[model samples]
Target: MNAIADEAIYSFGIDIGGTFTDVILHRGSDGQSISTKVLTTHLDPREGAIIGVRQLLEQWPIPPRQVGRVVHATTLFTNALIERKGVPTALVTTAGFADSLEIGTERKFDLYDINIEKPAPLVPRELRFEVEERLNARGEVVTALSQETLAAVVARLVEQRIESVAVVFLHSYLNPVHERLAAEYIRKHAPGVHVTTSYDVAPEIREYERTSTTTACAFVKPLAEGYLRGLQNNLRELNIGAPMFLMLSNGGLTHLEEVLKNPIQMLESGPAAGALSSAFFGKLDGYPDLLGFDMGGTTAKLCLVEQGAPMLAYAFEAGRTKRFMEGSGLPIKISTVELIEIGAGGGSIARANSLGLLNVGPDSAGSEPGPVCYGRGGDQPTVTDANLQLGYLNPDFFAGGSMQIDAPLAGHAIGRLADQLGLSLVKAASGIHILVSEAMASAARVHIAEHGRDPRHYSLLLTGGGGPVHGYCVGRKLGVKRLICPPSPGVASAWGLLVAPVKIDRVRTLQTTVQDGDLQAVEQSFLELEQEARGVVQESAVQHQKTFVKRLAEGRYKGQGFSLIVPVPDAALGNEQGRQALIEAFENEYRRKFSRAPSNLKIELVAIRLSVHTEDLIEEGLQFPSRSGALAAVKQVRKAWFEETGGYVDTTVYNRDLLGSGDTFNGPALVEDAGSTLVVGPNATCSVTAHGSIIIELH
Candidate 1:
């Protein structure tokens, strides 16, 4: 059949990681789930994705048209920025302020360091031309944009042969007349070049972030669009004519058309999926606070989840030279799920530095060369090699025996590292393991401290292939006593896409003082904002189950440098009581933040935010019945290294599929699955939950 018009309802979620292409196919009618992990084709991620989807569909017996939806997350744009591989882009801004991206906030993330490096601007100085126009903070055009000014800018762009152009006039977030005029002119004059404006991409406060975000969007617009269109056409050719969706960095799904125009929103889309999975699973288990730990082949991401919601921030940085510090990269004024990522994963390379000291990564081998054990022509020692040498991995059972790992090659690689360190192979392997663990802990500590969260109150949920292998040590360093490992943790990120809702978040700057501002004006502004946001959602062709809206305001003292978000009740905000209620809400939130609120200071409302989204598009169904099979066939013993014991130990190894509900055991133990391994550290107790996940208690 060319199409299955009356077939069962099924959906697919795809995530492209550095080393693997993870796919999760699920039946919406009954919650049947099938997952697969295949090595990533770095040259063309779509090649690996098609293979995985084809294999999954063949095995699960789902019809092509029965796959109603496909949600995707990829690292293409982020990697392009880091590697400086985007299209040739130019920037056009207000004449006097064209260099705002370089000026930044002028505050060094490391104040005492004299030689801190910042990533070069996406639009270099020579290519950043300026139009002679000005707009005051209130959006008043001081010097109205003229035709002559537009013509000159277009001439320069055409002469330089810029592939794309970004227009970022000052105060465009408040009013966009000038920016729109400039963008329209460039579009008409430069027929073949693409255009992006700050008003369309990031209509928010802060000039530097807006410019940076717009520039980034312009830089990747051409390349990302071509890649996505190629994949979409390929899928259509396969008789899978489903509407494709792309994941946003805010843990929501939007149509591919939206992402192609605003590529900056996809910078952290892959990592955000893991955080969303964390929040969903945490809510199901009655956990209000948790720490998400996800380590794949290239990196480890840590996010703080509170009250079933992952933390969110408007300001984000990408491609940082200093991984732990801010202000070392380009700032994007886009709302997104907040998380910290570091280079500490299975494929992280190990090297002896010029100082002759052992150094683990901030660099990864990725999928092309992978690790020494993968036998993919890699000669360098990596974390995977260390794990194999320490007996944490099984050589023959890797990738469910589909791919074989060479243990001898791994040992040889580790032996070279051991020789340089002047230590035994096991000792060097232990050092590599511990150093990466410490690096992960350092990233988590900085991330949590910045968010003002205490680690003792949060349990660590380990996802990704590399997370559980190092979770015990990292958790202990962060004072986390409880760890939860979900079933098929490595594929959780992809599964998150199947549950994501179609969402659109919009923000507009409206500077108003609470003491003297009109409540009627506040009520009117929010209504306009809600309508605008709703229009965007309604434009999409996807049919949502339910729809709703949430109104929020960013508030702070008149002289404060930062602002806090507070919820506003729609009905109460139209009268005197609503104004009173808003002030009280601000006071309550302020006291919660600073332990007290100043009664004398004036509270100024900075911005209005609107979040419009559909209700849970998919039903909650991660739970699975415990298996009734015997464990004797899957149970075995292996030699595993344990730092607590200061040597190798006989660790019990069990198959994850054979462990049923109510099954309990004590570590040292290793639980194997098709795609990942869960390590139960010494002195910990593990139990299988009703959902077939593992819960470990160290105290």
Candidate 2:
């Protein structure tokens, strides 16, 4: 293998998930990513990444030297926070605000509960130290930061053996001088300790969440940087000399240098890939509003895509003790690709509850000791066991038979669960599948409703290792009519990396009111935002690109504590009429959200946002000859359980690679591939597309 050249080309996109590492290779000439998957090496995720890349290279007969850019998405940051595996860290704040994490928003989400525990602070109270400093909301400093107090805090941190420190001062979002000075003083005294500032990292309102976000950034900075550096070195050693780009939770890519400073931005990186895939493929299916459904080994993720773009969120909570409960986790405000996740995947463990009713997971038998069917020393019953016992899986053909599964183990696990629940083995397996499907449907419903949407109105784009197997049941429960399972669905997320546009979102808080007639202030904010966003995109190293800007204001009627986001005109700040038009747009959006506009209420603006984008849009889906025949005529048949039918049905099974366009088949079918499976049940019809995808229409 030699280093890749400018003229030659294979590009790679790698997604390192909890259970698997998927690799997609693009042929330089066609720019089509070839996909494949490998079991994750939890001990060293990079090992699986390399193996997956090598496997794809071998199959395609492409030299390593031909490979160009490598886009990567990893769960390292998320895992570190979840497992508490990052380096020793401490927090420094204003004299009176040292307990920001402890004295959070102060509003209990579960107000009626007698005992509701809040999420534990990431940095312990003992390690939190404060310096005498105060900054007003308008960037005015009342008490200057003192060097003597900073030195004492550094001395104590050294004594406590803290390797990383985060500084967050009161109202620092408006004036960062105190936080920056404190960081410099600490760096001078504790030369080896990493220093992070809330002003530099988050610079937002909400003292507790801002501090937590900065602390988390510092907490995982060292670990993520080391891992990324190692991965880059390994790629260089393999002669794949393309610059590596990391996927952000916001569905954008950033260079390794930028990612190292803010690893928390990559929290939802892996799941974002799947959402991108759904959005990209759904467009080709003539569906602009699609609900992405991804069910893998450990969890089921749902994301909404409207007009071929996935929704974005500015606030996210991670490491929740209670999965669906708000305020059960630490809040970190940043631009994130919106998604809803549940514990309802193939490896989700199933067990009997105290009430004697069977329940499916929020817990999973992950990769190492996977489903009992994997014959990997796992004894617990999981969704995989239910699928296998119900004959949804072909024992020897799972993962293209890369690892043989033990049917006896699957049967035993399901049977044991059945015995405890006083049900037949078949009934218990079907029950598990239904329970999991309902859980998924319910989660999607809540997520969609939160955005004031109806699930039944959107088309479902299903992908992942387990999505196809349960998509129909989940869709049925949600009352969704159509399900689209694209080709190579298992590696769909990796493919998504190829289609994502270079995007940058910039936001700054600018509290003002239209009544104030301070248009220059708004203009200045947009100017600053534009410069900042352009700087980030330039840092990404994508050259010779055009920039498009979308100006938006977070506005609300007077007296409202929070603001609703409204898009403003790009030309608004330049003239008076443009400002009037922008205000009208705001009112229109407000009316849409609230269903009416208050006649006499004043309006206030809280924040201004600008997003820049550059994309090489390509036509989707290559047309191929359609196959005309019953799907069963071209593939094998297997038995799969149907909850609605209350019995097993003989289901036609086809290999995704072999299915061609225009091939149609009725429900009670399974489509198999190396990476995943698609299960179509009774009352459904599946038709193959020219690009080798399956469109399942539900009745």
lDDT of 1 by residue, 546-600 (tens): 6788888898999999899988765557677888888888889898888999889
Query: In the order shown, what is each candidate's alpha-carbon RMSD?
Result: 2.4, 2.5
* Model 1 residue pairs with clashes: none
The clash count of every prediction, one per candidate, is 0, 0
Q: By summed lDDT, which 10 consecutive residues of candidate 1 come out lowest?
A: 1-10
Candidate 2 displacement at residue 430 in angstroms? 0.8
Q: TM-scores across all candidates? A: 0.96, 0.95
Which residue pairs show collisions in model 2?
none
Runs off by more than 4 Å, candidate 1: 1-8, 538-544, 621-623, 629-633
Provide the overall lDDT of each model, using Cα atoms, as 2-decimal numbers. 0.84, 0.81
